[model samples]
Target: MSLTPLNNIGEFALLERLAKLINIYNKDKVIKGIGDDAAVIKPDIDLVQVVTTDMLVENIHFDLSWMPLKHLGYKSIVVNVSDVVAMNAIPAHVTVTLAISNRFTLEAIDELYEGIRLACENYKIDIIGGDMVSSNQGLIISITAMGYINKENLVYRNGAKPNDLICVTGDLGTAYAGLLILQREKKTFMANPYYQPDLQNYEYVIEKQIKPEPRIDIINKLRELNILPTAMIDISDGLSSELHHICRQSNTGCRIYEDHIPIDMMVSNIADEFYISPITMALHGGEDYELLFTIPLNQYDLIKNIDDISVIGHITDANEGMYLINNIGEAIELKAQGWDSFKKEE
Candidate 1:
């Protein structure tokens, strides 16, 4: 099959083709979409709007050699939607912007947008508007997601108080485990161009890395149970780093028991193969996209039976400091050692 170069198609024709791929899920809320100067939406009367943006740059955030454009596009939406879910909101619309080099074919762009469209379909969101521009480097995807929540239901990183139980939804560290598997396979393939990677056993971890889904179900479950988190954050930057954010913002300390931290069996097995501690992955590995939150201590019984949610620790007085209690009854001071975009690579 011949690949049509992006330059072969005029900008207007490209836009027309892209516009047809999007389907507005909430026509009642959206007044305008792709063709407009800016998308128009009717605001919810009683709910507050939440907006978040995330950028994935080639060679920095991802590598085209290993990362499929569709998966990258889907993940870009998931990452931003996770933020809205962290605020206890329902994601409604998104605007996708792209910076593409001439080397990428028009078909490549279609594959990327197909992923974006899938995400929008799954999340019941609308692709309202976005911009595409030429780039000299490589592809860059910037997505802005919008969500809405009632004022009373809004949760922030600054709301945790003493005696609030620290909770996290779903397993931790799986994405990083998946990333390790991908990197290992990438190295092997690079060394021998004809080598085929045996990835049947690593499907779970790889999917977590390439196509993570935000814990929107957990948000709905919390609402259904009538339980409101005092503070909440998505575990995008690892459990330890996210705990620090909640503690620092809420002006409280925390103590998380290592035994209480949830790690999937697959993640544990992969960590063993890598000769790395599973606990280390759980604590410091980023991009889980699970929800880390805190609720009043009295509400522990309310969430105890929920299989996916784990109560790992509790909030404490500001002077107590953040700590992680080991199985041996030792307390170690917790630190934010997760993903830092500006931190120089050692």
Candidate 2:
């Protein structure tokens, strides 16, 4: 017998290996199983069901010193809800499970639930049920969100066609900027216990990191405008990485412009302060939780007036190749240089 490190093979590879071991019994009921953002189930003829789960662990996914328990609770739910929204589905219910150590108090657990309650209220979802268990390690939270969409309205990552307009909701890279600031502050505080972190200036980015809202509003707006996305995925990873998912799934290529990638001024300033490239951050920063979707070229005029959505690029023929045209007019092949949790850093 031999032992191998999971990090050496990486997350996607690990997933692929694990997926090969499973047997899908009910093929008709399981519309989608292991690949997409969520698992699609055909519970009925007219309606399609979506189930998505996200798990957050202490230190690996978050730091308790910087990440408040309340925010963690809220974020766990939001991230799962974002997956449902990525499928163009409305989240109706969620089940949350928590693993806590002796260090976590009853009051602390209540605080976490309060945040979950607030998110449920804001998102108009019900907390159906979940589990609570003891953990020898640190805090861990997992949320599974279930939602439904009409069979006709359901969108997947593989639906984009040539010439479809690529769109994204809100801005990108703010969460990574916030994480940098928090880590910097944490290091400072570790060196000096009396020092108080001046986080007022980095409020927006910090909030973006700690408390992210799912793109339910964008889903609602798209529905109201009668614009169904041809292909879509939530930017849980990075813009470039998610774009790769869409392009690979749809069997199409994309041409996004550097100038058109939307970024907030606050994020830009913070990146500048950190001596990092804003565009690079936008492309490779993870945990943005924004929706990346494509629409038919003709439908562009309808969504152009929508303030938050940005038309950054358009889908192209697979033979044309995926690219990012720089400001100086150079076509650079896009790469998925985003965060990989399982990767072992060289």
Candidate 3:
């Protein structure tokens, strides 16, 4: 068979070419998929629908050298699902679109989807529909996640009030620490081809980077405790960035205690090796995928003893401004320096 460029075949033909291989099914919920103007789905009547989309691009979002394709596939789905969960919703379906260069083979695509399929099974979600197209450069994956929540259980970023306790699920900075370690290893490997990557010592931080779990458990635990967050956002863009988002949306300020922020011992040890503060990583690092939320002061007693959660701060009047109080009682203005996609690297 002659090797044909994707441009020679055109969009419709390419779609037709890939359509035969797609086995996306959603039982009775997906009434329409491909060959239609839009996907049609039947949502549960008692649940309020929530939607979120995320994109990952090669080099920018991930490096193929360090990121396994299967893990990349799983991470993509998890990130979108994390957004849905952040809104206090349960993910039910996903639409996956891919843009790939000719460098990708059918086997490669299958490998990627294998991870997606695994995630779907794990999360109890369905792959309703999506699109596939050719790319000019490297690979790109975009996913749109749909979820549902009862109206009374819905959460938002603008519902925080003064005196609400600011809390975060799981430890922070582990992912960023993992990335730093990977980058350093990659550089060393590039310089010395015979050098073996020593990742076993950094297993926890490394796993935190490549296989970070979304805080679905936090949402479940909150429900089990009969508590609902007044305002909530996922820690995709670091704790400080998420805190700023909640404060800006809720029209409130916050004061977080540096000592109160949760950090894994492994992450702190790793940060020491990197010559950076673990607190700095927690404040500005991104992609931890934990849940950061605020609850009423009255609800504090309900969550005081929850494992893997920390009450790091409290909401204050907007005029008070966002500040971080160090252990010695020094207050520093909080800054949001999370990942900026558009900003050119210096």
Candidate 4:
């Protein structure tokens, strides 16, 4: 029997295959292509359009071994919304396409949509359209989100300026730690079938990993505060990686304070148990779904007084380079070591 193609290929390659299969909708109006977090479309109106797509493959982005289908569905939309938020745009709609193998039952699909429904309700977006296809492989979900913003309001990675204040919304590293807890529990269960997996104490972190809320409210809140980010990127990737994108594209440097990086108490306690630095995990660990941004110095007072947002550091001239300042007052060069989905080890 001839083997199936998607069975052997990985998630990214499969995404590449799918990307090639689709025809461009507005080839001429497309200001940006499909590579970044969202596609930039210059609609006839003054407002620019932003589009983003995400694909989740079993055993790659997620593991059916432990992840619930419902959480998976909810997470699918949130991830897409996070991308739109990164562009400083509001997520207005999403088209979810699901590919399911024979292994999943109709009831399971309903459970999955339950999460999808919940996300739509929370994000206040409509499920405009999508498709359902059969797969010989495991569960696969792809989400495409559409966002809108005024042309002048659109923010990309290439706008940070020297002396700009670096700020982030919500905390970091909790989702990454949540991933660790889930994987660790899976291992514990695999090692001994009787092991129930000690995850009760790690509830908060694990919940963060399973179902994350996109910072749509924060985006609106920033507008209410009359703050415009000089540059903005979501924390789907590590903080260091997103910061590097900001610094490199903006031709600026950032000095992130070690003590300023936010960490939930549960995340810190778990990091201590694992013999890891909470700050390190928050910086290098990926998928917090928070916003990393730089605002002009005049806006410093606006963010500094905000309880939910923190002014972690300041941007500098590109010649200075990106560095992290420890509590001891030493500056260390920051590295953007993002999680590699393809070369991931079990």
Candidate 5:
């Protein structure tokens, strides 16, 4: 085992050393590798290309304390894949760019890439090419994903119309509740050195926070049924935020039923322990990484039979605007007051 003088060697030197470690998935598609301003890849076939990127920063997006390097790498890919899934496309390739400070070592880098490489295998995506730079700040990982879709099958955020049904994939807010548990556990550890945090419980909630998968299967099923979302966006923001985006983009209004929002049983129990309503967690709590979109009213029965797809609401006339129809029938405005790490005061 050996330690790298990663700091003293400087950023460019580290990049030079790391150059040996990476290669394009297809040697032929790589017009240029690590040295240039960017790496270019030839488009596959006459297929339409979709591109998306995600950035993860230390402490803000991840904590090294409990997060395994493998899960972190897997998460980076999932976030990018979610963007492709939002577009109703199957993600086919990804390029990972990493920035490191003096804190990490060669062994640590291997663990991180080990996770990244495993995600490539699971998602059936190719690792094209990427840049490794040394930074003065803590670790940062930025991933760019590429996906392919038929021109006719493409889904975007700007297609909703009146009477379209609002649909979402899987459960929501489990990830958000899971995050609360993780942060609380992390705090407990920092407060008492002798106290071992009791994490005997909350495994399911924790798993959602740590390793989320993009809903590509649902996208495929929808396509198989000859259905296309009137409008679509991944649920990275809270449900309230996403619905608002669909409404604004498509020049439509929406109404969601409070009871229809999907929430997992484990998340519900944990939320009760924390004195939080699972519904509130799903509504305003972000990071579910699910898909939220609208479909035509006639397509409702076609989509409902599919497992995990929930018809939470529907698009309405422009005058109605976007709001949630509570169980008691009271209407409330939808607002997106989600996590804003960039705005936090140091």
Candidate 6:
């Protein structure tokens, strides 16, 4: 099959094709979308707006060797949506921007947009507007997500109080385990081009890494249950790093149980294969995108029956310091050793 180069159609034609792919879900909220100076949005009168932006660069954030453009597009939106949802808000709109080199074909760009459209449809979000630019290097994706929430429901990182319960949604460290499997397969393929990777057994972790869903449902569920989170953050960096952010901002300390840190069976198995500790991955492996939050201790009964939510620990006074209680009941100081964007690559 002959591939159509992006230069063949030019920028305007490309935009026209992309605009056709998008379907605005919140027609009442979006006054204007694509093909305008800027997107016009109708704001909620009583709710506060929540906005977040995230950029994914090729090689730095993803490896195209195994990462499909479609999945990359979906994930770019999800990472930003996760941020908005972390604030106890439902994401409503997003603007996607892309910088691409000459090497990428028009068809490749279409595949990426297809993934974006799917995510918007699933989340009931509108693609308001965005920019496409030429890049000297590989592909770069930047997405800004917007949402609104009632002032009473807005959760921040600095609202935790002593004795509040520390909770997290879904499992942790699975994405990092998926990354490890992908990296291993990539290495094996690089060393021997003829070697075909057998990845049937690693589906769970692989999917978690390639296509992680934001914990939007959890936010909605909490609202239905009338459970307000005192402090909240998405576990994009890692469990330990996000916990530190909450503790530092709230001027409180934390004590999490090692066993309570949820880890998937597949993640533990993969960690064993890699000769790494599963608990270490749960604490420091990034890209989980799950919600970490705190609620009053009195609300424990409301969450105890929830299967996906785990009460891993509790907040404490600042003077007590942050710690993790091991299985043997020994306390270890918590440290943030998760993803650092500016950290020099070894």
- How do the predictions measure up, each by TM-score? 0.98, 0.86, 0.91, 0.86, 0.90, 0.98
Can you write out model 3's per-residue Cα lDDT over 180-240, one digit (the tens) per residue? 9999999999999999999989998888899888888889999999999999999987899
With candidate 6 superimposed using the best TM-score fit, by how many Å does residue 97's alpha carbon deviate from the native?
0.5
Candidate 1, 222-295: lDDT as tens digits: 99999999999999889999999999999999999999999999999999999999989999898889999999
- What is the alpha-carbon lDDT for the whole of candidate 5? 0.82
Off by over 4 Å in 3: 1-28, 32-38, 343-346
lDDT of each: 0.91, 0.84, 0.86, 0.81, 0.82, 0.92
Minimal lDDT window, size 10, model 6: 337-346
Per-residue lDDT over 219-317 for candidate 6, one digit per residue giving the tens place of the 0 to 100 score: 988988999999999999999999999999999999999989899998999889999999999998889999999999999999999879999999999
Candidate 4 positional error at 319, Å: 1.0
Estimate the TM-score for candidate 4.
Answer: 0.86
Instruction: Quote the positional error of residue 210 for candidate 5 in Å.
Output: 0.8
| Top candidate (TM-score) | 6
Q: In model 3, what is the error at residue 197, expressed in angstroms?
A: 0.6
Alpha-carbon RMSD of each model: 1.2, 10.2, 3.1, 7.5, 2.7, 1.0
Residue-level lDDT tens digits of model 5 in 103-184: 7876677678777877777777776667778778788999999887888889989999998899998898988888888888
Question: Where does candidate 1 stray beyond 4 Å?
Answer: 343-346
lDDT of 6: 0.92
In the range 212-281, model 2's lDDT, one tens digit per residue, is 9999999999999999999999997799999999999999999999999999999999889989989999
Candidate 3 residue pairs in clash (backbone atoms < 3 Å): none
